[model samples]
Target chain A: MSVSGAVSEIVAERWVERTLAAYPAEILPFLSGEHDRFRNPVGQVIQESLTTLARELLGAMDNRATAPAIDALVRMRAVQDFSPSAALRFIFDLRPVIAEVCGEVTPQLESRIDELALMAFDRYLACREQIASLREKELRVRALSPAR
Target chain B: MPETLVQIEQKAPRGDWRDPHVEFRKGSICYSAAAKNLGALSLPNPRAWQPMDADWKLPPDWKRIVLDGMKERLKKYRSFRLFMDICVRCGACADKCHFYLGSADPKNMPVVRAELMRSIYRRYFTLTGRLFGSLAGGRELTEDVIKEWFYYFYQCTECRRCSVFCPYGIDTAEITMMGRELLNLIGCNTNWVLEPAANCFRTGNHLGIQPHGFKDSIDFAAEEASEITGLDIEVPINRKGAEVLFVMPSADYFGTPHYYTLLGYLMLFREIGLDYTVSAYASEGGNFGLFSSHEMMKRLNAKIYDEARRLRVKWILGGECGHMWRVLHQYMDTMNGPADFLEVPVSPITGTVFENARSTRAVHICEFTADLIHHGTLKLDPRRNDHWIATYHDSCNPARAMGLLEEPRTILKSVCRNFHEMPENTIREQTFCCGSGAGLGTDENLEMRLRGGFPRANAVKYVKEKHGVNLLTCICAIDKATLPTLLEYWVPGVEVAGVHELLGNALVMTGEKERVADLRGELFAPEAHSVGSASEASHA
Candidate 1:
């Protein structure tokens, strides 16, 4: 495998191991599908894709990549007609998902994951509020328009 | 040949010899047996119904202005966004509509109905529409589209029944509101709605009827009340320091059945000896039509607070109108905050206080009447209502919108001995519209009216056929006006009356015998009181 590919696999393997360790026995039934990924020979493909996507999000150099991720989240939410409250609730759930996957990695990386998750959550909240204000202003302007 | 006398005699037929159906047909026949038994009450003709100079001219860059405005609003809330986006275009909501079931028009389909606004939002705001345009079925915003929006949005009563059945809980009422707000942005509003809204903004009533005219109407009603109750009680208007501010729709000042309800309130107030005054300003308590446009609604409601502040009244009593009660129950308190001076209504007679005080403390007329009856404040003769079998038609504004199902029925049952109910869905929160509600109660939209009113008319028809329900009682002014039109087309023989009309009939006035004999010659008797004394007694 290429060096970058191998690095991704290592990161994903570390993540899965930490997830299994951190999760309580009560949640074991829900964790069944990913167990095969850690044990089987074909697990690398699934592992590489997830880790690469996470790494890309984490390593986003400018606002463009972050924006696309935000947009994707918004679009998915819009399609489901999820309220801003519901969307924020989902963001809260993402913290535990990240912690379960990466807590056993280097403490530095675990802390970095936590910080990144928080930043994204704050950004999403800001975007939602901005959108809501814009909408209200639009309603007022439309209400006053002459052509209707 | 005095013109006023000729008009009075021509417009006002003698009560004793009039046909109930023909009396209703004349439109000017103000007194029925139900109203006469309560007292002689009459609403004033605003006497002036002129159109005002409105800002109908569109702005120079109107298209850009309206489109941008709609996009901005659509982008604001996740709840609105979700509702707008997730509609699957399923025709399930069509048959569920009283209008659609009545009219059988595909445009009445709630999904399609909402799409009138949804498609506009899509074209202006969505990326798919911006990039693909016509390929994605997006059309340019045109005058015709605006017309369609006007036509369909007003067709809705904003009843919200279809929303209950929607899997996604998508409210078409919200969509209709947005559409109307957008339409008003470009001066595309109808004369019937905008004129009334504008008049209410300026003159404190929808018909632009001034204080003198209002006072005259009240004086006439007070005279009628005096005739029946033998009490020289004045129907006070804009009287300062009154304990209660009696607010009702301007239509009640002139509409039949409604006029009697107004008198019933007056008589009950006098009987209970409560201090009250009707506002010369803020004459209307209902503005469900304004729910579609925030600006117009805010402008209209601004007077209520202003008038209350001016009069310094302690509490406001809302009349028996559906949409008016809904607006007061749900949004009025939120839109116009708490009145620190006012307390939740506590009955002077019974010492009972209204419990469900939200932001603003307002009581529906039925609640007030029901409480009075519950406390044994008023003497009733249930036998007076026994002339014909009767059933209740639930007005949409008070039922599903406000959870006011029991109060009206409770009052009706307590007053009327022969009162029967329609099917379960035909009453309560699941009740059908009279089809002429929301501002669709106009004469111009006959086809749409026929369609939207069909479901309600059909329900009334079923009751009339199976149960011999001759009198259809509801507690709304709009129903009184519109149901007559619908009954004419669908159920020919059934008649509609206000809940207060029934109560007025059953009210045991102190000097009814002397007043009845005195007015019997001047007023025709046979047409007014169709039900014989024996029939009334049997049910009593």
Candidate 2:
């Protein structure tokens, strides 16, 4: 393997690790340990999403590639016990992890990370809105229709 | 930033699994038991207390109360005593819990969750734990331990999926129930449980729907069903000489999707010309007390038999509900019965006596409907449900506690033409919980419900992607109430419904108007290549 490719891979692996660190320490083991997609959807999805996000950032920095992974992670986080800042906080962790692993993050990569964070925020808002609408729809149907 | 990253990454794993520490995150916990609800039931130590607060305002003798309560329970319930002593931490049940699978929290693992209570039992009761302390995996009953108990015990939905796989046959649901009972002793409880139980005790239903309100809801459902079927159905309320008393969770009359099932029940009963009465006095079949305390469970469950005897009904037929069946099938006779006043449930339409329910004298609506269909008593047109490529979710209690694995499926397959099963393991005996059962279905705990529902939703997602499945059916009221929200969050486009709702759609009611829509007011699609023929061709 080429030296640059190996370097990028190490940085991406570190990025995934740093992203997982944002969650509570209690669940860290299972999130990283369990590999079965059905048994550990949250863990598998979080890890896979971060890995994909890292790869997308390192490659073409494609919005199409990164949006889905970000959507999956952000959807899980939005429903969890996370404040908006905390939900989006992991996105910020990527820059430092990349810099520490490779001694530098290129200017283009830094901007891409920022763009990814913005997309995550958008997805997070969309999920919260969806939850609100779903709850409203449920309440409407749950109300006694004929009694009213 | 780098220092913070290092700190986050370098944080050591928790010291031991036995350490009593719980973080009360906002979305993960339930609201505290309302003081009024506890006081209404004459429970001890009624006070408003937040779970997040350091001072739980527990009684001064909280520790003694808990240990003594545990001692009394240990003597009374042999299963509890056996389960406490029997577990070997085989880890067979670890991944079986929906909460553990969803959140990946080790304590959510069934073994670890049970151990949270078992560890306290060890330190207080076992000789080795008393002598060796930490070495023997014993944990002291600190305030933090009580706090942890409240956190984790409530997290369990009491679905009992873990017990299905346990080699020692440890009933983790009982352990959770025991843990909750002990928590209640210290006035540590959730309002999601206590309020409904208190309401059930007072007004005879969880929502505290008074007799008039209950009648109104039933009248409304019957009216809607009459409009759909063009038959003016007679819904008897508190009739003294009715042969069977029909009781279902109050949610059926009020909650969405559940209301449609109520319509289904009304239409099916009318079509069959069965002699039945809907009692406003016994409006709820769900016993939230099962989630509270054993005594509370017994107190709440007695009403079913009480109403049956008072109304002089020969037998009782329960509507589509989950835990309601569990209590009726498993605990009702022992807790509230003999029920000698009620006769064995003999299906009037099919003449099939429910021998399985001869003791309890109560039959599930699925069993009743399945029997009728089996005897060819009702004419069913499966094509009515052809628009729905459906899959069935076996509600935990009905599937596990009662072993009601096939009755609902028999009915669903008979009614829905385009039906699919989820992955083999995620259905029937090994079914995944909707994650919002056991009084944890409150909006405050929505995040945990979603997390807990992920595995169920994942399986649904697989079938949805593979078969274009758009409907998820179950017979539980709680499933009807919560699965819609869970599916919307995790697997959008898959609507939730009750088995009987589909049955209502398919059941050709006598003198009924030409049907164009299923229950829930959704229109059936035009016959543009029927899914029935396509699915048959694929099978062929």
Candidate 3:
């Protein structure tokens, strides 16, 4: 792997660690155990899901699966009443975290992360659109049926 | 000295950790349902906003509306009254909760979940609570508290597993239902559930499949069933005077894994030549309203009996679904009818009577099929499913609510050779929710679903490692949709399927050709069969 690719891996792990650190430290360890069933296991599931998305996002891989993963993360964020800045910031928040980890990086990685932020914004908007459309469905489609 | 059970258990991942003080966080909270869906239901005080919004725009009379709603519900449901009035806080139900077990959130505990409402019930209804206030575990109903109601209530799947261990039989499902109903009075309802209920009310199915579209789906399933069996079988749609009116979850007709289960029903009905007719008007057995309010549940459920009487069917045969049975078995007769117009359901082919469902007079498909298998009505080839080591997931509603456990397993044992149960605690009445039932199965709530579904998945992982069990057979439509993603994310490659789907795969339909693939659409080629069997055996 290229030096930057290796750097991305280190930064990605650091970023996931940093993002998880944002929550209470007490609950952080349970994040990866898939079999940890309980009430409101949502906390751990979100951490693990975001961790995967962060790693895959920072690596800047062109895998198609990443799109849905990104969409899912944003849907979770957008549905909550977070400010647009706070909701989308997790993707862009990688910049400072990555910089602090890598010490120094080329503009290519930086620009790529910026592009991902834009994609994250678009995906977030799409989730909002879905919510809006579903809400409107009751009124607009009462007479005419919408195809599943 | 021998190592004790605790020491041995401590050597691995501990399942019994207890945090004495559990705190709440925004982490696992669900997004607020949009205002329009609530307005569509004509609920009072609807407004557009998110759960995190600073202002919820409550009507001036919101408090009165809620208190009045509570007053009315208490009178209507004796269980609600008894549950509310009699709770000694035994703490027996705390660890028993899958959500509390999975997340360690105290509020997720059944007692704590009820306390959220019971505290309010105390604040207004009780003498000591009103005087002493917080000291008496009572609090005034406020906006933040309303948000808490939405968060915790929607968080619950209303599985009712906690009710079993409770000394008072305090059903949290009833509390959760009442919480949701109270929320609905104020126009707080989730769109994922409201949309499906509305669709079912209008189109007779959750997916909103109109009569023609419903016919198209049945036609397609018939074609595919023929492709597998080489027997062209046409399913009846909306024909009167049919002996039985078959009802099913609409997801079976539309969703991928679920559609395969639909194919199973088609094949099973054909094999017995059952005198049944599918109705366009009462097509849905899965009631999304069960996730919402009682009135909505009744409105959505009334169509089934109405269509049955119109079609002149003597009895009803419900398909493989979890919560659908909860309604049909427990609530249907009370909410919908005397059903005196219809006769007791008896299998014409097997000569077996469903005495358990004598009052409701509706037979679960598993019970019906199990009876047929016992009577040797059809030849089942177990080797056809030699590749899968299956474990049965007793979905929460059917197992706990109605006790329809052994019927599915009996059918599975008859059809599939390699069947195992998950660890005893996780099966039967103690089953975990798919994490996304009761209307929280939307994309937005994916994180919550994954976590809530983790305990069940964790138990599945245990079996997968221990027994090499690859197939997780369940009989819930919500499980069909949610478990696939939940299991795939947590324990990949272990899949979900309905019991009927497996039976369809194993059934040697008369005059049928060699099966090319199982119901999952995986190739069952002769060459792959030996290799698959060898590998699957090694897994066991």
Best-performing candidate as measured by lDDT: 2
- Per-prediction TM-score: 0.66, 0.91, 0.76
Clashing pairs in model 2?
none
Q: Cα miss at B64, model 2 (Å)? A: 1.1
Name the top TM-score candidate: 2
lDDT of 2 by residue, B1-540 (tens): 677654433223445677788888776789999899889888888997898898999999999999999999999999999999999888889888999877757789899999998888899899999999878988899999999989999999999999999999898999999999999887888998998898899989888888988888889888889888778986999999999999999989888778889988999999899999989889999999999888998998899889999999999999988898888888988998878778888988878889999899999999998888888777777777888999999999989998888988888888888999998889999999999999898777888898899899989998999999999999888898899899988888999999899988888776677777877777776752232232322210
Return the TM-score for chain B, candidate 2.
0.96
The C-alpha local distance difference test score for the whole of candidate 2 amounts to 0.85
Going through the candidates in order, their DockQ values are 0.01, 0.35, 0.06
CA deviation > 4 Å runs, candidate 2: A1-33, A58-62, A81-104, A129-148, B1-15, B528-540
| Over 4 Å off, model 1 | A1-148, B1-60, B75-79, B88-92, B132-139, B288-292, B509-540
- Cα lDDT for residue B31, candidate 3: 58
After best superposition, candidate 3 residue B430: deviation in angstroms?
A: 1.2
Off by over 4 Å in 3: A1-148, B1-36, B525-540
lDDT of 3: 0.75
Q: Please give the CA lDDT of all the candidate structures.
A: 0.60, 0.85, 0.75
iRMS, all models: 29.0, 4.4, 12.3
Docking band of candidate 2: acceptable
* Residue-level lDDT tens digits of model 1 in A9-92: 555555444333322332233233433321211122223333544555344423444444444333223212133444334333
Ranking the candidates on lDDT from highest down gives: 2, 3, 1
